[model samples]
Target chain A: MILPSAIALGREFAGARFQIAPVRGLSVQDGLVIGSVLVLIACYLLPLGAVVALSFLVPVPGIGNYWSIFQNATVHAVVGKTLWISSLTVGLTLLLGYITAYALVQAGPVARKLMLAGVLLPLWISVLVRNYAWIALLSPGGIVNSILIRWGWLDQPVSLVRNSFGVVLGMVHYMLPYAILPIYAQMARIDSTLPHLARSLGASPRQAFIRVFLPLSRPGLAAAAFLTSIMSLGFYLTPAMLGGGKTVMVAEFISIQVTETLRWDIATTLSTLLLLVTGALVWRFSHLLELATAKPKT
Target chain B: MSDFTYDTGYMQHLEQSVRRETQGKTVHRRRFLQVLSALGVSIGSLSFLPSARAQQSELVVANWGGDALPAQRDILAAEFVKRYPQIHVAFDTTGPTPGKIKALVESDNVSWDVADRNLLSALELGRQGLLEKVDESIVDINAVPSQFRTEWGVGSYFFSFVITYDAVRFGSTPPRTWKDFWDLQTFKGKRALRNNVEGVLESALLADGVAPDKLYPLNVNRGLDKVRQIKAETIFYSNTSEAQQLLRSGEVSIGSLWSTRAQGVKEDTKGRIDYHFNEGILLIAAWNVLKGAKNVKDAWRWVALSQDPYLQVALLKKLGWGPINPAANKLVPAELQAQNPGSPENIARQIVVDAEWYARNYFEVQNRYLDVLAA
Candidate 1:
């Protein structure tokens, strides 16, 4: 019985040794691909995982963090604000971007190039600088306020940067590009003659646009809305700077909680919630066209 | 679908997008790691540079982002090397204290040997057991203000949070208290407040008529309500950079800003701006040595040199941050007493933030505060 057991053990050892051999050059290309994919996934998920882990960890084990969401009035309010801002930003940006893209397609080549250049110029300048510029434009003593004051539009410098209006304006300015590019790309692909032909056939411009153009541009519109929503939801500096003190968004609130209250669990909980919100939005975006255009099974 | 490609411009733009996206993928895959490695080399060199003697290992000292940080750090470096020739001091900078310390400690890869953390974060980390208690013998705590020195941080006083405004904008009637700030009808057009909790709450309560000395065990609900009330009307700035820019550009006429930044505004404008100490919040950045630091002796010597009044005064004059060393009084020929936060007299008036309290309650208050604003 001992001899038979030893023989079986030796066979198992030999099999294990056999498994270790000839991994040599066996598709290092495949290994590289697999390794690269693993690294990329790890890179993406690890930080997110850590954030989630941090969220659930304190108040000494339980669903304390998740439960705290209900207890914390601030978290609930900020989340609502985030949703409102994101929706408004997406809606406005898509409308404006579509208009600009349409205008670009209609303009003369030189005019279009210049217009395109103007549209993309904000992309190059710093967001901080642009936000500051907006502040300058909106402040009471600054250009806009000075002009409004001179023009007798208002008695004093209206509070712009410190309010939600300013926040929206600045965000829309940034989000406009997100809306513009995709729609413009879609519009350029659309046949110019379709609208012209519709006009010749007695279709009004509005009808032609609604019937012909809107459906064709669904992908771009979806894309623009999706992109704008994601960006608007995650904005920290814009709301913090432009909103002044009156408006507090999720990002600013998270920083405040961590720094001022030292409530690590709550802070992480909020951050994790934000991540989930954005992640869900991203998932929605990735499947936007699919969900919107899905056909019923016969 | 085929008729979609419009003109040359559109085609060119499309081409550019395709090219850019393709390049982004390449950069993300291969170039990202390459660039990271390259940056890692430079950053590694800065933070772990070998000694000139090639005998001793490196001690990395991480600090803030600014012209002033480098200037102060340079003096510390020179003096550090003068006394102990064997050891080398390497410096690094991370953007903010809370996020950076959390990242370093949680990652279990302590990238920093020593870091610049303020009183609040220092105390917070000390409670969390993230910092190594300073070697008392080397630190010479007797030279430090008893109030300033703590188990976690060695105080090198920076600045007080002073309310600075455009003198031209405010006229003779400057803001005397947080109440002055609350009365937006008189002090109109966007008023500013720092986004952080400790100071803002104190200011809001002070505006609500809470005495500075009695600020702590702060009435959280009352403070949150005040914050919401002010936040409903006031604009908030999070970063120092944003606040300074807004003030300089005349985007904001009145806001609570760093004393150094406020002083810079005053000095830059030849006193066109005025900084009021009526209800300032005192904050100081303290040097903290990490627990796992490989070069403790070197870090201590560096800390010792950093304690010098000459160096401190030079730092005071050159950089806007106030010097902690009482000896810096004369080296700084400027009459800092009444004006600068570091000055002996100015330091007395401002509310001392109970950082220990902040460390404990920051998140709860911040969340509540934000909620109130959103509401």
Candidate 2:
């Protein structure tokens, strides 16, 4: 009886398969996919949805919070400063990171290992420690000034830390490792002989680098720029500590609102705006990445 | 092929066992899910459990941590426990910012019984109904000055933002007033100011020739203008420790620093750094009870115990904090009298911060102050 039923069921399954190709029934994999999507909704989207809802509801409902964002001059100044500092940080990080990545690509094995260690070791240290170290080196009576003064380089100690320049410097230091790894990874993938091949073909070394090497490194440069700029936009500690309370960024402004002023509406609104800006940036970068990768390789 | 069995009974047995195994797995999976859901519910509801029951005998005091924690534990907690052995005292070192207090009360989870915060914060939170009123019968309401006392809280201690100057830099003639601090030609050196509105605005006003008695209803524009005059030469410190470092390292010749931190810096530099209470902006730190505190009785008792003249003097000695209880002034040693902010001579020279005015205008003033600093 069992054999007859099994044979009948197999025949029915075979008959159904003949109707549509690749139309398989749900299985364990499908269950897993649905479960993960549900988890994402519950954990990530739900809390974010609450924040967005709060932005509209608090201090009386409607778009009042967003309107305040426009009317408030402090917010405008802070946002403008953040954008300026972030752009400066990105430009400096990319230039310095590209040089380091190029050196890493050209170094021999032992030198490469040592150089890699130099780049990555600071990441292992705490950001607080690193920023404080910068202070110790850059302050008026700090080591840098002491050395300069001893060498008769100046009449008085120059102000180094506690300004936009100091903030950018610390930011560039932090962002270098993040930028270097990606650029290094991309540069390492390029054929080592390509620039040499250009040199062999009667091209000057400078022309070879500009024509052959630089174009190949565009994707990595773009990735590094995108990463550094996004990270810089949200920086709080480096600017707060090194900026001497002058370089107020958006993150610190939001913090002041949340903790000091107790203006949850303003904090949430700024947070939502930051999220949207980050999302837009991610969207724009993805397109750039696509364009970079889509370009024909020389 | 010769050994293979094509028997219907054998095939039927195999199919039956497979069906039984899958059925067992389904039952096991269902049981596991049931247990998981039960755990989730229990864990989620745990927050709603009556915290008061577990904390009946225990009182939690929250304050800004650092040196104050040890000083509080050794002086205030030790003395309180001696008085009531049955009660246990605990501490939450996370500073009780107004934001945290508001959140705790609004969420109906008031974990801290006593919170050490500023008079401005107490006024703000008290008006919002987030703090419990001080029980006049239990607490000695008149121990501190009437201005420092309120229905919602009492002054726990006093600290002032005094002019701290590097004696090594300006040993002959130190800055005694905010006007001298702003005098670049007479006393030319970099200056440090706290990057907050509380003491800063008052100092700026005082420097701009606004009399101490006429300081309230602060001329913010005038104050900002005075601050901008020295803005290029000033480095604003956000934390008290940063102020100490700036002065101690000779980075700034003069700075406005909390009296406690100034004292520490003076000691650290062996009197090379000195601060005078002259023209200081005296600020009060208050002890407030949370609205739904579990150990309200114990909290009141703690506040009352903290006001003991001897204990207040001990706290002053240990932490350089000025005693809130005026009675503690007589108990302070002659050597410490000059250093204490509450000393009659010192208190007369300084102006107490107007908490009522600050509570009303702090939010806007702080924003403007930060804007000026950033600019």
Candidate 3:
């Protein structure tokens, strides 16, 4: 209605045969937009190009580096550790984030706003600060261990820092907010009436949640999982700080090669591998990204 | 910029350690002469020979940039410029050189004239033909110590991995050896060990009572099992900075730590931590000149200047490291000198890590260790 009214008003004011030509507008405006996009493309292309070039040059290629990655039990072990931590963090973040987002929508508006702010507080803090906070919070004399020991749950302070479990906990906590925000945005657009209707049709609330809302939230869940997993995959500092050099992640392993061990080909090759894996995940979920940004229900 | 008055103070400063290593070489030669004399060998049979390779002045040396050694290089460069004004000295410091050497050598992109490499790094570079044949013209023939006179290596600095315990907590009855460290039941609280396999392995082997000379061809299985035994109790630190932080917070009661790192903590803690060298991990920092060197003469000059005892002592005191120069001993305070890696008591007590054996098994053992940790 608004478009037709505006078109008629435009014809009266300008010319009798005015037409809204989006194609013309897009093409003309594309000069600036396309140019900006090309500039951004160059920015991304430069790093990717260097990485592609490096993997081939170092170790004389012919899949020697990749073969080493496969054959070398140590490198594979580190990569495996990285995969384990990243996948676990991603899974837990998605489940917890979706539940929290759903709960936020169900809560009172004022309470929802406060809780959402609390959820986001971790996200806004620097990753390093969060890592240090984890150190203090989870260390033997730190708050958590102190409480646990006081409650007779643990006889002595367990070795928490520099272990895989602490590393995953810290990573999941850091990635939680990133997961929650996207899921919340998706769930916020989900109309409450649909779930109410499901409950009215003899389905219990859990059934209504699982059958009605969960299916609708799948796209967001995919996107949140994708983002969280990718972020966790390259986590060097968290694992280094919390893993205590015991649970070496791929990023940390690669860094040790470059900085301490001085194995550039292996480091660069591993980084290239990390890039490929991350790209594969993004490509696999490209459709979910589309769904995530799809037009909100009319 | 070309004519600035450079400070050769660090290079010109080593007197203590340079003298010590030189004395050992001197003693070896003298003992050899004494043996020859005891056999009634005639000195008249030998004729004095002319030294032909005395004219080279310029050399290039490279190492990991911004560590304790570069300051010595700077001083050495200045000293070399003053001594051999005709010989131009250029130095480059880079990060660890395993991949760099491999890539640089294979591609014929070799830039380093001389490399101050870790033991393993040197072995790898030398194996790849990246290291140059070390000519001993500049080195004092009779004064060159054990590894310095090697076919492929020059002795640089010697440092230690000492057992530093919380002095405030264990003032009198501090843990002395690897056995004491392994006994966590007595040590009390948590224990920290180097996450790097070297110290962990060394401690295990030492506790096993393997002779220092035979530690090479390491018993890796034994080391890993020893590691596994303490895996639950040991807080392994890979990040160098974390060791000191762990000590400060009392998270670790005792730890096997780099001497310099342990000393760094003592500065803040006001000697709250005690470093004992009874079962120290002694290491030699070596300078290996690449075979395809850009500046061979400069590398030699850097090595010669590094051999200066004044510079050795100055760098060690300033950096909490040990010097190759025997003369460095005089510069260190008599009390602190007792703890220095170059000191007689400390040197005799510690075992020199065998680089050759480590070079052979590093790749395999590291993988195995990683698997064990993961498992």
Candidate 4:
């Protein structure tokens, strides 16, 4: 009986050793892919998971934090203000970006290169540096004011920086590149002859351009608006700097809760809400785009 | 559908990008393990290095990081090392936020032996048991002002949120008090206040005619109402630098600013800008030994060294810091007394911020204050 028990133990040990070998049927590429996925999950997904979980857990379990959002008038005002500002920012960015992209596409080689460089140069500079530059240019005694005063543009210096106007200006400046790039990519792919063909078919220049060129750019326009609005919704630094504490956006408000108040529950809850709103906006916009583009060509 | 080759379709593009990224993965196991071991060895050795020096008697001090922080550290370390020559003194210029201090202590890996923190922060952390006792045996409690010293920390220096204005912008009648600061009709142009609820609310209440002594258990509603009156004209500054910039650029004619930052503007503008300490709110920064510090005894000694009247006066003279020790006041030069928050005249007029009140009600008050500001 003792001999049989020893043999059984040896057999179990052999089975355990066999299990330690490389997983069967997994090629090197498959192993690499699995490892990559694991790394991604560990590095990125886990921390995000913690944030979501903490939103529910802190300041007592349940939805007390979320419930308070409705009770507070300030959150309502801030959310309303953020949405309004973002919509304005999207509109301005889309208009400016379309014009800039159109000019870039129409310009000669050297001019096109120069225009593109001008558009992208601001992107290279640090956000803090850019904001500071805006402050220098827009402040009451700044270069722009000084220039305007010297040129007799107005009697008193304009209240440019540290207001809603300043925040939108800073945001539009930051977002122009994001808007322009996608629209430009789509514009570049369009056949340049479509508008000309319409004109040749006895359509007026304006009519041809509106009928052919405008409709063709709808997809790009939608994509640009979607990207700009999403980016605008989460803007913190530019608004904080240029808004000058008056025009408080959602991101800055969330941070104030985290750093100043140390109410992690409120911070995480508001963050989760912002995330949900952003997702809904993207979904709604994508569906709208699908509906618009789904129509057959005339 | 074929015309939908916009960037070759988003999904296909993502797949191609992933393929491009994975194609660069020629990681040999030996090389990978060697790199991993290299990282491990460096990190392991780095951890061991501090412990090895701990055996040799060393103390690490942490403070705010900036261009000026190094100069401040060098001055303090020079004085500290003079008396304690046996123990090596080093400085870490990572600013001590409550979050960072709590993180270090909670993780049971407290690298900071001594840290410069605000009085309220020390009390809050002390209550949480994240900081050691002040070691009163070493740090002479009697020398420090009764209000400044605590069981967990000793005051480093005193500063104030005083009224500063652009001399060019504001005519002869510059705003002198918090009342004048709130008097938007008389004091024209934009006004700036610290974004935080601390000194800001105190200023608001003072402007609202609340007595200095009666400022505790702050009338949050009245203060908020007062702030709201000027909220349209006021642009709140998040930091001292921003406040200084607002004053310097003439974006704001009047600003509620720290004495140090006001002095900075005055010096930067060659006396074109100035500040008055009338109704200034007093704030103190204190030094505390972090809990589970490797060199607690040495940290206590360092804290003790800071209490020396001579060193306090020297710091006052050099850095414009108001000495915490009451004895250091007599030693301060007459010319610097005007800038010193601890001076008899300044202290008489200024309100000492109730640190105990703040430590207890900071979060709840701050949430309401933010709401009020947002509204």
Candidate 5:
């Protein structure tokens, strides 16, 4: 079954490629494409190559850096913590974003425009400002605590913006738009009357949503999860500010090694590892998405 | 009328010449190529001219920017420029973290002539051969205390990590020693500590009853154990401003903060936030010239100028950084003496940070410190 679907996906991709193939030989457009590829190689790949080379060459060369990092329990702990936080952020962002995107799809034209503006407006603000805003709202003496205490919810202000919870809160707030836009785009492409068709076929509302709408939006859910998790993996400032130095993430740990400890070998080695893992994850996710979308007609 | 006709005739002549030039396709293309090449050459040379000129007279002094930028510019750089009008001083305030200094020196593009860093950085970078030795003949090394002077760097200023607490919260029974700081049951408030291991270990050791003099070659495990004692009720602040904010906002009623930031917070809160100098970990901020600095002589001149007793006093007045020069001690008024970290009275009470021990063990110890915090 999997083989048949994979073949179908390969055939679909080949058909799409042929559909958009250029007609003629080298032209100005071809030259521009070649030039941009060369520029990308110079700008992006060369620096990445240098970083990988430095990881091996520094601290007397060989795989000593990698060997030490692998044995270092701190690196393992930091990597685990980073993965845990990224997964948490991805899950929260998807749940909230899916709800918002669904509302957007069902709302009136004017309401949709206003909701979109609300979502996209935050994206325009600087990330630093957003993180700081979360701090102001969730700190011990902040507005949330103030309100909770005034209502006699508790005697003491709860710890909010200085732990894993705060880091995830800030990250989810920042990642909401990223999650919403992709899911909303996918939802918009989905036929609105499909659920109605399912209902006419004697399906309950919940059943219709589960069987028809959820499967259709799976690609968008996967896209959102992939984007938020990838972004969360690299987050530095949110975790730094919100975690209050307790919740050490990979990016912050790498920065410490590079700047404070002067351990470039360790820093570059961790970076190279992160790059390889992310590359593998990206490849796997893309393949999974392709398989999910491919259908072998009976 | 004659001028207008001449301009029109010249325009007509130029148009006719362009038409003549374009009459031959090959010549037109060749002329275009020549103009493009000339434009590229002139623009490229123009970009190089200013950099070449700057290299002759400019000396960059890198320091952590904030309130220090304006103070250093108005005082130290201004004095240096006044003495030697031939040399101009510029400030690179991106901070001179040791890693940055190493990268700059190794890349063979050392931009900073003199960097304002800590004693540990000076010793570490000097050991790695990233810094130029201080020219004794140019800089008066004896101006500062012997402990603060090094072959590759000289004392820039003195600061300390002191216990800063909310005066309103503690009132008359304020926390004094690190022991009091660790007494969470009595203090009854959240505490803040520096995220880095530099002064944190000293504070922890002092809290654990280690004598000031015996704090060298720190007992890393013991210090971390003491830190873990209060880790549940503590917040580790990464930067000085965060430490101040933690105190000012009452997020943490007490924090171990830099003397300079503690002072700022005290004044900002109108004395509601106060710091104690007792058991303060005194650390020296130093000036080191990069190994391949473009203006070595000018850099030495800047360092020498910074050491002048009067200039150091002036900096003390503007910023609360204690003057490194002992002579500047006498110049500090009685009113500001209590505020000065290097004052005779304050110095007597505080423990000077063991720079040598940190220079060797900082990386390993800091990793452990971070581990304890994260754990």
Candidate 6:
């Protein structure tokens, strides 16, 4: 019995040594990749954890923060506006992005490259700079107004900024690039022969597009809309800049609560609600995605 | 216009979080150097890093960026370092907000040692026990006015929301008072007001014939009604930079703006733009040390150095901020004193904002103001 126990101990030590030896043999690149992943986890997950924990803990524990969402009139109005604006942004982005992506897929190589550059150019510039540029162009004395007035369109410059119209215009411009890339990626993957096959089967061009092309692009459309809507919900800068101080949104209001009012209760409550709404949206889209991709019953 | 400024308490928490991330990188670099030294590496470049770091203690000072930061660096931080060669000062040019200060203190990982914050922010945070008690042993507060000094902070500077106008457009006569600012028949042009409810409420009340001394416990309805009369023509600005840009471009003939910004624009435009402190709403800015700051002792010393009258005068000359130390005003030359908001001549004409009243009723007032604006 003693001999058997000694043997078991030796086996355990050997197993631990084997694990240690393999770790020592790890290449520099392998170590670096692992290190990078750990850094990402520490940087991203830790703050996310704090925000999540705070959402429940603030203004007294037990979902009191979440409860305030239904109680406050200002919060209610802001959330309604946020949903309306985000939906409108998603629709506009999808329509414009689909047209642009389709054009890119059908264009010649040189034209495609140029168009791609145009789509990607704004991504390179900082959002703050781009928003400022939009402000300069859209303000009453801005270039657009100057040209319109010069061409005798109106006797005076009209108010084009500091309102809902300006907010939507700025948001749509910022979201277009995000919307374009996914649809374009999916469009590039389509088989060129499918549409041709539909056409050869006695279908008209429009019918070929509707029957074959559009169905294939549904995933891309959904993805683009999902991405744009989620992004639009968190937008703070564009609306704040273009809408002036008059047009308030959820994110901006959350920020104001945290900074000006020092009301962590309200800020956390709004944030938790926003998180839930975003999560619900993503879940709904993924559910639709699963249904679409599910194999037919044999 | 910028998103955040000294007076605007927004986005400071984001800036502080970003600063904390960068501080992590500096720590890593120090650790890397330590490891190199342990390996017996004798590079001369590496030697300087440890030696320089070991000799001097670092203190982080927070202030508003854009013009105020560089002036503070030159007049205050640089001067402090010069006086105490053993100390090194770094300016974190993210404007202060009470929320960020509380976050730093509660986390017990304070990155900023000295914060340039407004009076109400300091009061609110101090009341919450988030700031270090002012080290009276190392610093003196007697020179600062009683209204501006608290147990946790001493006033750094003063500013006012002064009426500014385009000189070319209103060459003969500019809008001199809140009443003139409200009168559209005479000015006959678009005007700009801060997007803030605090200044707007005060100005409206003042314009509607509410005495400055009697403006406390504000009449919400009367102020709102006054604001509504001219709401159609007034463009609201979110920051000083935007307000300056609008005025500089002659887009708005008359506007209410911070004194420092108006002065800067006046100089930049060669006096095509101008403002006066008559009927200005005075605000006091303070510098407080964080509760858990690593360099509290040095931070107190640095704050003390800023109280020097000569340095304060130099600050007033460079930036249009009024010196909080009364001695600084005496040191300021007569010519520049005309522009100094702290000078007795100017202070008498301006009404000091009731900090205590604001600390209690700010949120209620802010929400009501937002409701008014939205309507």
The candidate maximizing DockQ is 2
Better of 1 and 2 by TM-score: 2
Model 1 residue A162 lDDT score: 65
The runs of at least 3 residues in candidate 3 whose Cα sits more than 4 Å from the true structure, single-residue gaps closed, are A1-72, A107-116, A146-155, A257-273, B1-97, B100-116, B133-142, B148-152, B288-296, B327-333
State candidate 1's TM-score.
0.77
DockQ of all candidate complexes: 0.27, 0.29, 0.15, 0.22, 0.26, 0.19
lDDT of 6 by residue, A73-189 (tens): 777777777788888888888999999999999999999999999999988888788878877887777888899999999788877776677788888888998888878877777
**Residue A152, model 3, lDDT:** 97
Docking class of 5: acceptable
Clashing pairs in model 6? B1-B242
Where does candidate 5 chain B have its weakest 10-residue lDDT segment?
B45-54
Worst 10 residues of 3 chain B by lDDT: B46-55
TM, every model: 0.77, 0.84, 0.77, 0.81, 0.85, 0.81
Clashing pairs in 2: none
Better of 3 and 6 by DockQ: 6
lDDT of each: 0.70, 0.83, 0.70, 0.77, 0.83, 0.78
- Pitting candidate 4 against candidate 5, the one with the higher lDDT is 5
- For candidate 1, the per-residue lDDT at A178 reads 72
CA deviation > 4 Å runs, candidate 6 = A1-33, A102-113, A184-217, A287-298, B1-56, B184-190, B224-235, B367-375
Evaluate residue A72 in candidate 5 and report its C-alpha lDDT on the 0 to 100 scale: 91
Q: How would you encode candidate 4's per-residue C-alpha lDDT over A1-298 as one tens digit per residue?
A: 9788767666555445443224689755676788789768644554455456657766576888889877777788788889999999999999999998888777899998898999999999898998889889988889998999999997799878888999999999999998887677667666888888998999999998788887887777888888898899999998899987878888998877754565667777888888888889887887644543354454
In candidate 1, residue A205 scores what lDDT? 92
Candidate 1, which segments miss by more than 4 Å at Cα?
Answer: A1-39, A56-63, A104-129, A152-154, A181-220, A251-298, B1-56, B320-334, B340-344
| lDDT, candidate 6, B1-375, per-residue tens | 132124333444445455555442232233333444555765355321121222137888877799988888888888888888887787777666666666666644567888887777677788878788889998898978788987888887888889888888887888889999999999877788887776678889999999898998878899989988987777777788988988886667888898888899999999998999999988988788888787899989988888888888888899988989977776889999888988999999998887787777787777666655555
**How far out, in Å, is residue B369 in model 3?**
2.5
lDDT of 3 by residue, A1-298 (tens): 9788766666554433322223454653565577678657544653455455556555474677777777767787788888888888888888888889888888998999899889977767888998898889888778888899999999888767668888888888888888887788788878879999999999999999899999887778888987888888899888888886677888877765654454556777888988998899888877776777778967
Residue B101 displacement in candidate 2 (angstroms): 1.6
DockQ value for model 4: 0.22
